[model samples]
Target: MRTRFPLILLLNAAGVALFMSWYLPENHGLWSTLDLAIFHFFNQGLSADNLGYAWFLAIINNRAFDGCALLAMGGLMLSFWLKEDPDGRRRIVVIGLVMLLAAVIINQLAQNLIPVTRSSPSVSVPGVHRVRDFIAFSTKDGSRDSFPGDHGMMLLIFASFMLRYFGRRAFLISLVIFVAFAFPRVMIGAHWFTDIAVGSLTAVLIGVPWVLLTPVSDKLIGLFARNLPHFTKMNRAIK
Candidate 1:
């Protein structure tokens, strides 16, 4: 576990940097081809009425759903702490929250720094249904929130943390959830492929390593530990 942590951290950092630097941001022929094809395929033979297809897209596009997902994942993450003693559990929780918060903050700020102008298939592609046509929903004034999807960015940060601690099983489950939830926004005309691809990778690289490495995680855990007693006393007082 000790040796593996650094390796994973370095790899994640490298992968994210590479994608951010050259892979996703650049308009390559293959990317455009795949994006166009995937957009058409998802848009076709699907409707908002059933399977919550369009409904799912509309709801999932909102940031609230992302909050719900973080809560759900936080519960799952806290489960790992349940087995540990209070100090150990508190440390892990602190580490996890630090990791999640950092990735989320960085992802949000990076959007402004690495701004990319793109549009959803529904808006850019001819004959594609506008978002409202699929469901009783529309974006804020139909503005494009393109590039490095915030939804994808947020979830991947949480999921990536889970991946390291819980192993392959958790990793695969996180991947499934990511696809199920994050893909719809793009399908329904909220983001481009690169938006998710880049945003998620950025979060994963940042969040996963912070927990996996030492002294850093330890320092964060210690910081939170100092306040837990007061928090516990407050809890007891409330009770």
Candidate 2:
């Protein structure tokens, strides 16, 4: 299993590199053309009639952005409350953070390396109307570098971590959540489809195997358990 994890990580990186190979801007015309087509397709189809959808997207995204960390930590605490396996839940929280951190690093590289220049779709698509519950967080400016969608990458990172502990079923559900939240950014003409897709896969390729392959999460979780000895009673009661 030890050796296999590294091999799997390498294979994942190879596959991502293959896809990124075609993601060139002035470098590759065909791939650039495809990306633009998909981007426009998503951006053009958005409508105010889908306000309810926009609300769902906004709420999910808001939770992801504003309170995802709290949710994760809360889940960790809840694991103790529920008397579940401490090691397993601890692994999920720590690894999820690791994946998010790795994605941020990868995002920097992607934005700098293969930066793509493009204009966001017209506001007629889904302008950032100041609705009570809906906040359109699209990049209003037309021409800009929107290569890798950060929010999408973050969502995928979270989802990928959930996939490991829960099962394939959780991954499918997470996929739906990713699309719901991330697609809204594209819908409002903030990002391109490829931006989200490539960014997300980049995260999965780099983050997943790193956590699973190493004892990194174990050490982090152990450190957490050690420093927070105040929770010892809860830990024991749960046991």
Candidate 3:
């Protein structure tokens, strides 16, 4: 933890630098160009002639499919839960609860504190293919207010927490979950590339390090574990 202080400062500095780089008026063209290129690359697959691809997009963007992403995350956490001893399992539960609290707080801060106000590329960009235009399903293809993406931020927080608590293997799996789940929004044009790459990533870089890299998160988790004896007692049957 002592050695991580420098990294925490570095990450926070990088976050500030990244956000400023995108926010400045002079850099808008460069970032916008990158955003459009990535958006078109993924959204180009939405063609009236490609029913298979349309269906694929529909399934992933559907609200129901979002449940699958949540389930995958839950499954990953449960894998750790099952491997731990009684006290360890209690700590795991406390970690999950702490993670949820942290995610909610961070998301609200990003949404309200950030000055960005941009619509989804699907709605703002001209002459782009839409998923609903091809498929009759009720899938999300655009958003009126798509700035720092909440979905991607949440996934990133989960991945970072995994790395801090669990080993690198868990972190790797969480990374896959982050990409697999977060990319759908970009692929379908519901979010711009910067929304995740610049916006969400920036938020995580600054916010997560302050908690994970310091003793703050561990202290909070320990406090929860101490007070929430019922949760710890439930694991008594395990060993």
lDDT winner = 3
User: What is the C-alpha lDDT profile of model 2 across 1-239, one tens digit per residue?
Assistant: 24457577685777478556655445445765765676566544335666765565345445454355445434543543455465555554555555566557666765665445544443223453422324455323232556566667776766665565556766776677677656766654556566666655665566556654466544655666555444447778899
Query: How high is the CA lDDT of each candidate model?
Result: 0.64, 0.56, 0.89
Q: lDDT per residue, candidate 1, 155-221, as tens digits?
A: 6765665665567776677777778677767776666676677655654565456555545544655
Model 1 residue 18 distance off true place after TM-score fit, in angstroms: 4.5
Which candidate has the top score in TM-score?
Answer: 3
Model 2 residue 202 CA deviation in Å: 2.5
RMSD values, in order shown: 4.1, 5.9, 2.7
1-239 per-residue lDDT for model 3 (tens digits): 54388898899999989998899857476898999899888888778788898788778989998899899989998998998887888788899999999999999998999899889999999998888887789888899988899999999999999999997999999999989988899989999989998899999998999888888898899899878758445577665
Model 1 segments more than 4 A misplaced: 1-26, 46-53, 59-68, 138-143, 165-168, 206-214, 237-239
Which sections of candidate 3 miss by over 4 Å?
A: 1-5, 229-239
How accurate locally is residue 40 in candidate 2, as Cα lDDT from 0 to 100?
61
Worst 10 residues of 3 by lDDT: 230-239
Sorted by lDDT (best first), the order is: 3, 1, 2
